[model samples]
Target: MNSIDKELLIKMYMNMVKIRRFEEKANELFLNGEIPGFVHLYIGEEAIATGVMFNLNTDDYITSTHRGHGHTISKGAELKPMMAEIMGKKTGYCHGKGGSMHIADFKVGMLGANGVVGGGFAIATGAALAAKLRGSKQVAVCFFGDGASNRGTFHESLNMASAWRLPVIFVCENNQYASTTPYRTTTSVENIADRAIGYSIPGVVANGNDVFDVYEVAKAAVERAREGGGPTLIEAKTYRIKGHFVGDPEMYRTKEEVNEHFENDDPIKNFKSQVLRRGELTDEEMDDIDKRVADEIKEAVEYGRKSPYPEPEEIYDDLYV
Candidate 1:
């Protein structure tokens, strides 16, 4: 708990709960057809986003993946705009054009959530290079999946980032599957972090289900980057509790495996138990945070519902071509 302050610890708890509940709401809305398009719910990996993002500054940049609502929310994006974006409302972050896979808020240094696997690599690397050139302390974080690690973009980006000594961190959310194929079947390495050896940068691995574990590791990496120590590769071992996308048949895994993670490996529940056991936070405090987050999410969904959809004629707007 070297990096964990009481306030930040509590905030992390609140954020974890917020991400979990928000995804649950998104799932409900998608099932009801209130939200259009495919939604890959980030239900189980709440700790990874909350823990790693807990110490970031407003100037720090973060690139997100398709399962990115959690990252967007953790990076301090407004709930209303995010919900509206997912709902395809005109008031959305991208005027509803980007939808769930492409919500971005540059003011907060969130580059964007990309639908393409490994798409954020170049953007994050570029952001890091810009920061270094401008003599700024901003660090860039690229969040990709285990599947993305196998792509050429990952290798190309890492090679450049390492060579330049850019202030970037590559975070791989290894959920053990690339769509329908198991990660082990595709990736030759046992641990994704091991690949960092080729780049000659620090490679670290942490339990994604444990917020404190992630926080400790991320804090060190962030501090090192700010001190001009260059890039780090972090592989968070997490599990996706849902199908790759909403309405997926999910024949790749068994129900028992999913249920086991839900019951035994739930990060929120584990954090709550740890905090209560250590007297870090009282039950009343935890309940209060939960209530507040619930209310916030409730209002966000209502706002999205009441928000107007983009007019058909507005399609030509915000386009370069």
Candidate 2:
């Protein structure tokens, strides 16, 4: 709060708020069968995406996880196409060919959300290597969960990145539970960031609920990547508010656990409080921004609902050169 400027602080708050509302609406639509395919909502983890995305340029690429709606929005992707994609409309980013997990906006530098665990680690590493070989200062941010940290691709990608000094930031969104199983059961290390030492890269951990904290850490990592320094691993400790996915039965954990994070450690609420406490924004102004973002999401859904579905013949449009 004290570290960020008023404009950026307000913007960070706005982005996190936008993602939260959008995902909430997504859950409602998905339950109603308006959206096709399952979506992994990034409800309580908005701060990590918003803060990390702020450090990137539109030209700097990022690869996302299945829970990628926040990444797309933070990367400046339009809401209509994203919703349209989820709804399986032709107007969507993937023209209805790819649903929630595969929707991408390379125009905005989102490489696409990966469905396979630990897949994007290698993809973003390759992108970074490409950029480095081409002598471009562009950096790549690879977003994955703590569960991926145990995957072989994660270690391989980091090893390659470090060996060649690739410009990439491996941002691990450690949201406590990895689909009902907590990290304590699966991961031995108390801190996921500690794994970076094996790769000989810098590592840091930040409170994922605090957008300001994430932004500061991500800024340093991005600067390091841009300056041709080797990769950095950032483990953002957060909480995922929703179930593993839509329609998940509460078999793994208790309601009390999820409710605690939603009510207490909610990232969006925390961001607004930090900004308002600093007197950077009045409640009235924040309300206005909230209204604006809500209206946008509303229109986005409307546009997707009214837009035409994909034509039968157009299925082969992007299939070949």
lDDT of candidates 1 onward, in order: 0.93, 0.91
lDDT of 2 by residue, 45-115 (tens): 99999999988999999999898999999999999999999899999999999889997999999999988
Q: Estimate the overall C-alpha local distance difference test score of candidate 1.
A: 0.93
> What is the clash tally of candidate 1?
0
Candidate 1 lDDT, 167-221, residue by residue in tens = 9999999988898789999898999999999999999999999999988889889
Model 1: CA > 4 A from native: none
TM-scores of the candidates in the order shown = 0.98, 0.98
Screening candidate 2 with a backbone cut-off below 3 angstroms (N, C-alpha, C), the clashing residue pairs are: none
Cα deviation of 52, candidate 2, in Å? 0.5
> Candidate 2, residue 208: CA error in Å?
0.5
* Positional deviation of residue 116's Cα in model 2 after best superposition, in angstroms: 0.8
